[model samples]
Target: MPHSNSPMTEVLVAADCWRNEPDAEAVIQRAITAAAGNVDADVAGADLAIMLTDDAGIRTLNGNWRGIDKPTNVLSFPALQPTGARSDDDAPHMLGDIAIAYETMRREADDEGKPFDHHLSHLAVHGFLHLIGYDHESDADAGAMEALEQEILAQLGIPDPYGNREGMD
Candidate 1:
């Protein structure tokens, strides 16, 4: 495993969107807990800024950063040193950032019939994992990642996202 020169994981969460939901803080903390547990890492003194923004902001970000020109669910920019980059011995490493689109998240929750908190928690954990270099680009990779996600969510008291016997629709 690659570790930043720092001793903890940093989370920054910013919410610029309308939130009818009142438990964003708790949701974010739950995510942080799940992420930290999964990696067996601790969070050092850090700043986690979560933004609750609309599709416009997300779309702009997606276009500028990812070249996708679309509003996606979440995006993570990891500040972890590049694959072979050296760590600065003195400063705490900065774990980049995670951005989530609020509307999309809510829509997904409604569509899936999963509680909003559960869906948000899942995304938060997922984003944090990405910050630590986890990805699901291939079928096998997705299976592994999803399994870990399921376990983490379960630990957080979320139902099995894939426990249904039929399979994903």
Candidate 2:
């Protein structure tokens, strides 16, 4: 639903890292751009913020926002209204924020035996989808969301994240 004349989306990334990776910001920006392009909505004029932080930072945020005291890989805070309605035009559409935990993500990649970069891309796509109202609270919803993630990742030359895990005990 992107308008033909829509402007380019803006991505702002901030890394608050204790153990940082080279080119992390650039990688995240690429992932966000790719994910945004795949979405149905016209996000050409939207602005997205991504924060690369460690487990402690994300754990604090999770506690404050969702009352969870532990850290997760990624957390998305959507700015669009609950009804999916856009705000006023004067205000550039801020598509919420995505926070990623480095330790958790790296550990997960090691555990899964996947490349760190590829896993990071998957998480970025997953978080971007959440910003656009995608969820997996149910089996059907999970399938749809995972399918979209797979499609997006494929376009980015990344393998299916759930390929080996799916249908497993």
Candidate 3:
């Protein structure tokens, strides 16, 4: 949060199905900002993208990138640089790109008995953590990441997303 600002996040709605959540962009922005602050990551002037797409759109990305054939709720593609200094260059250093699936996220929200925005916020925060090098690939790593996610979301008035569940994909 250099200059007391978060990353320059671009929320792109690439699918018509995402229209179902008119506040998707706002929710994602808020969640990402909060996550950056909580993690003390100085991402100001860094560029990131949040793609709001449907299952099919995300599936293609997953297949191409992760060698997976199915869609997931959220996927984060972290760039080479985590954050960068203010520069006069035309493009700021990229932090990462996060893609979220509308149908999958909606289904998860309903199935988990959580509000759509709550689930959305969690996913956004989770993805942001990944962009900043947080991961749950191991038991200890998962605990630390999950704990931070809970703290960040709680500050946004969102309940503990892992209260009733074992984990998220």
Cα lDDT tens digits for candidate 1, 1-169? 2223222443333455555667875676766766665674444433344555567888988999889988988888777463655455645555667777888988988888899899888887787777777899998887887888889898889997766547565
Prediction RMSDs, each to the true structure: 4.6, 3.7, 3.2
Overall local distance difference test of candidate 1: 0.70
Ten-residue region with minimum lDDT total, candidate 1: 1-10
Which candidate number maximizes lDDT? 3
Highest TM-score: give the candidate number. Answer: 3
What C-alpha lDDT do the candidate models reach, one value each?
A: 0.70, 0.79, 0.90
State the lDDT of candidate 3 residue by residue for 64-89, as single tens digits: 99999999999999998535454585
- TM-score, per-candidate, Cα-based: 0.79, 0.84, 0.91
Give residue 90's error in model 3 in angstroms: 7.6
Q: Count clashing residue pairs per candidate.
A: 16, 0, 1
Error of model 3, residue 157, in angstroms:
0.3
Model 1 misplacement above 4 A: 1-16, 40-49, 80-89, 163-169
lDDT of predicted model 2: 0.79
Put down candidate 2 lDDT per residue, 10-118, tens digits, no spaces. Answer: 4344445523577776566677777777778766777777778888889999999999999999999988554555557566766788888889999999999999889
Which regions in candidate 3 have their CA more than 4 angstroms from the true location? 1-3, 82-90, 166-169
